[model samples]
Target: MQLTNRSKQVSNKEMTLAEKMYLPAIVGGLAITISHFFRKKPTIQYPEVKKYLGPIYRGHHILKRDEQGRERCTACGLCAVACPAEAISMVAAERKKGEENLYREEKYAAVYEINMLRCIFCGLCEEACPKQAVYLRHDLMVPVFQERDEVIYGKDRLVENMNDRYIRVANSEVQATPTEPSLTRAAT
Candidate 1:
């Protein structure tokens, strides 16, 4: 069984004609191929056929405004603290005397920002907003083009028009319609 030479020796083992034919192996392979071919396709066609994302699915963040055009963000910094990715940043600003109609709380966000590229869309921002100012809309399936700075969505992009169906649902009140960001533009 051992060869004295370092060179390998050829085996004397012989295969049966049936083994050479490989009929069983071929049949089994064909059966597996057929089953796979007949199996349902699992690929989701996007754009034309968007997958039904859950209602709570996190996509983007938005700071909401009330019917009187008051900012819903209390500048609580809860979202900033909760974000694992550290994508959120905000500066608290004191609500001015007449600005009470523009701010829901005494402390409003003077500068609220979310680095979309850094955000994980974990919904923590939405959850952390005590004022319910942020929510992930089902329609936020827009494709993100690859570029140096294109992926970073700012307050302008995060904020949508009130006409959007998702915004309407969020408003959920007759008085809220007029003041919705999409419906009314804040004076620059």
Candidate 2:
């Protein structure tokens, strides 16, 4: 195709009076803006106030206890096996004959460590515990620090007794007699 070299007749255009003044555009914009000023602000100020966490929200790990208040973890290694991140480590020891009251099972974890840096907090380890020895709670209340090494949680940091409400609730639940068809009940 032959190019049309003749400079195409330039089309000249001018803004209409309303467009040129720019007043209508600004007024139209302000009409919508005014509605926002009177409406209640939905924005929640963070840090000043935190939102409510759900009952089962998995935030941080805690070692659980049985009704007798003994450590629930038997160190079965299932938690370590279930950990996709390999965050859990344990040294299991045999419970001597006289130590049955101290340990729930024949084996107990002499040393337990969970590298929080490596842990994704997926709650998989909690699910893997047959004795229900672990859970995540809202009391992930502590602020994290800059040091990575400090994040590794040992057994000492993991165990916690119930707080006021939890203790009352736990005790109430404890006092309630267990019904038949034992598998039907949900623990907590």
Candidate 3:
């Protein structure tokens, strides 16, 4: 029973004396190796020079704050739910009468923690954020830690700093910092 019209074309051709010796094959491989030595070096000098990750790369998690310096996260648990690795965890707390300036909404995240060990950096938490509060910084990466406690990031480390804010602009071209001229500048 033929499965189809397909059949193997077996070559029973005899090899020449040169093909049997494999001297040409060795010479061809040597030529390739020699050519690579003359070519430009592919490795970059680490520490002194860092590779630029694309704008959409998901790195360390950050809970952003609004222009008014109020916490933007409403403690809605959306980011936690969106995290496929179950890395995000937060405890919602009601904002007090006098603490309105501290938080943007009535309900706020009192305790937010992201387990770095469990997180896959999938960027789902950033997408699920309705208030645009949670984001993964493309420039900043999560550093290696010896202790297990250091891997779990809390609100203290995740909150945005007023002096240094991570601004994600359009096109994923450039991330203009506080010192940069503009955020939406064309790739130069």
User: Candidate 2 at residue 150, lDDT?
Assistant: 88
- For candidate 2, the lDDT comes to 0.70
What is the TM-score of candidate 1?
A: 0.64
Residue-level lDDT tens digits of model 3 in 1-188 = 77788887788799888989999989999999999989998675544445555676678788899998999999999988889999999999999999988999999999999999999998999889999999988766787799987998999999999898878655545542212233333222
In candidate 2, what are the lDDT values of residues 1-188, reduced to their tens digit? Answer: 54778757676688789978999989988988998889988665544434444354566677876776667788989999999999999999988888876677788888999888788878898789888787865434334669977887888888756452232122223331112223232323
TM-score of 3: 0.77
Which structure among the candidates has the greatest TM-score?
3
In candidate 3, stretches whose alpha carbon ends up further than 4 angstroms from where it belongs are 1-28, 45-48, 170-188
Error (Å) of candidate 2 at residue 63 is 1.1
Question: lDDT of all predictions, in order shown?
Answer: 0.66, 0.70, 0.82
Better of 2 and 3 by lDDT: 3
State TM-scores per candidate.
0.64, 0.69, 0.77
Better of 1 and 2 by TM-score: 2
What lDDT score is found at residue 81 in candidate 2? 98
Ranking by lDDT: 3, 2, 1
The Cα error of candidate 1 at residue 151, in Å, is 4.1
